[model samples]
Target: MDQVRVAVIGLGMGFSHARTLAAGRIAGGKLSAICDLNPAKQEEAKATLPSDVKIWNDADALIASGEIDAVIIATPHYAHPQVAIKCLSHGLHVLIEKPAGVYTKQVREMNLAAASSGKVFSIMYNQRCNPLYKKLRELIADGELGEIRRMNWIVTNWYRSQSYYDSGGWRATWGGEGGGVLINQSPHQLDLWQWTTGMMPKRIRAFCSFGKYRNIEVEDDVTAYAEYENGATAVFITTTGEAPGTNRYEVTGDRGKIVIEDGKLTFWRLRVPEPEFNQQYTGGFGEPECWKCDVPISGDNPQHSGIIQNFMDAIRQGTPLIAPGEEGIHGLTLSNAMHLSTWTDHWVDLPLDEDLYYELLQERIAQSSSQKTVREVGPVDMSKTFGTY
Candidate 1:
């Protein structure tokens, strides 16, 4: 195909994707159709999208219509895997929004479907396009920092108001959107944590504060500790209830340390590797000489548009995907481990027990309740809600 036709499924987060595609911002790609069951969302799309663009309420019909070669699944946390599976089964390229799914078992099934279908599968991990992170990953991969010893990210800048939760009935409920901060606002960081460092924790222990600062049924605050097989440790802390919050990620290695904060990347380079310095120095008071350097980040953060272009390029030109759909399970694995740790009051091991996690998640869903009144909200400038890091 010279140009890949694309359809966006959910109008909530998918609306932004639909608008971008409809505007023809992505070369080699055209917005051919949109599907949303909500009449309000459909009308909004009709008003905003071109007249020729098809609109449908049934996703299955859109997939079977053969009007598009690919579908961007932007539905809620649960429907992500379901819709992607259906689209892949129909022999369509699939790109779904973050967190993959509410649980790992379902995400695994979706990944299997993608593998069997042999279709281009990607995830909307827009933050991966951010130059800061791109450079960070490059530096780590190039061994600018030696073997990682510790990682800490305090990304609490995702502050959300009560009305934000009240705007939709599915916002924070376990039965609906799944979990809060970790699943919603912090998936990018969770993904980036392992993506940049090239490591997944061997075990995770987490403490999640359910509705600690909001009137919701899910976790709005969380602090997780993780240990890697290489003896490296990581700490991930996030919340949607703090004002004047901070976004800081620090990674320490034998060579030195790197910090990304305040939109700047800084590296404290050691004259000699710490291990070398420690062994060579006879003076007990002496430490490795450190020089502070401001790392230059020179590239535009194309964000969502970049990912779309990459997806289309992958379909039309056989380019590799920026975020493969199968990798979505890594971040979700960390997330599930956190939730399981909290639910079981114990540290959970890697290669998670998918059945046990599913069982526990079902228990939460069965007992889930939402008492907040829904509020009508206007269009959210989603760009502003992207990662603060």
Candidate 2:
């Protein structure tokens, strides 16, 4: 592959995307075009991008102009499907940002479009390429932890202030960004949860707190329970209100527990119990069978860069996507399930009713308190809030 020419949509995050592409982190990719509805943002992009790169106000114009072979859709959550479908219909490969679509039906439509177009359609779930997460999956698959029993994730470090929500009218509204942390910050964790576990939940029940941190109609704090078909259970918690929050995951299997936090993973191995103790401790909690411990993590890890490179490699070698566009529906489903469970006070099963989820969203949209024009929040300084991780 000489060069995988690329265009970017939504100059807010697209500016970052364009910058990364220009960095030439991807061996055979180049920033080729930029598109945004905001002329100011387009100008900002033009200022940053090489003079040869074209800028367009309309996505269709950019797609039709054929200046690039692929597009990176970094638009609002609601715009992902529409923009992806348009790009795919135009015979361009697409790499859409997380939360592939606001709902699964839109994702299905986009998937169908990609299938018909024979183009590589993938979601930007870069977390799946994280070295720690990859090692976690490998350990689980290797049966180092034995049969999986449960997984718990506390991912509240995604702290956001009311000012953050106030930064953009479209940010925390149903008609704009769809959901809150689940859609915005938790997609990466949600993708990691399922990706590392190598399983999907069969059912989910959750309760979400709205208007808890910001004046938003959607959830800012969510606690959801997932039940797997094999009788395994998982608990997921995410919040935007809690400062000095926690980012930790604990996976407990029959043999041991794997804990990951602050980019460090620790494994606690269970020791084998004596035959007499095993017999005497029936129906009770006691010491386990023979055990050992290890932290088998070592390498030159390129998390974000690894994912970007994977995208380029997938495009070049026709390899499978680490996170396929269709897989995004699972994370979306979990997020939607949390809201649905909270709104209706019910448990939601897999293959959620698209009409029902959309209906619930439409109700929230109707009642949404935001009427301000959705402006780009990029120009504002997020440097303080998005501190060094």
lDDT of 2 at 54: 83
Candidate 2: where is the Cα deviation over 4 Å? 272-285, 289-294, 372-389
> What would the TM-scores of all predictions be?
0.94, 0.90
In order, what is each prediction's RMSD in angstroms? 5.6, 5.5
In model 1, state the lDDT of residue 325. Answer: 95
- Clash totals for all candidate models: 0, 6
How accurate locally, in lDDT, is each candidate?
A: 0.87, 0.78
Error of 1 at 178 (Å): 1.2
In model 2, which residue pairs have backbone atoms overlapping below 3 Å? 271-289, 271-290, 272-289, 272-290, 273-288, 273-289
What does candidate 2's lDDT look like per residue over 88-164, in tens digits? 88889888888887777778887888878888888888777667888899999998877788999999999888888
User: Model 1 clash tally?
Assistant: 0
lDDT of 2: 0.78
| lDDT (10s digit) by residue, model 1, range 14-45 | 88888998888999999999888777888888
User: lDDT, candidate 2, residue 105?
Assistant: 72
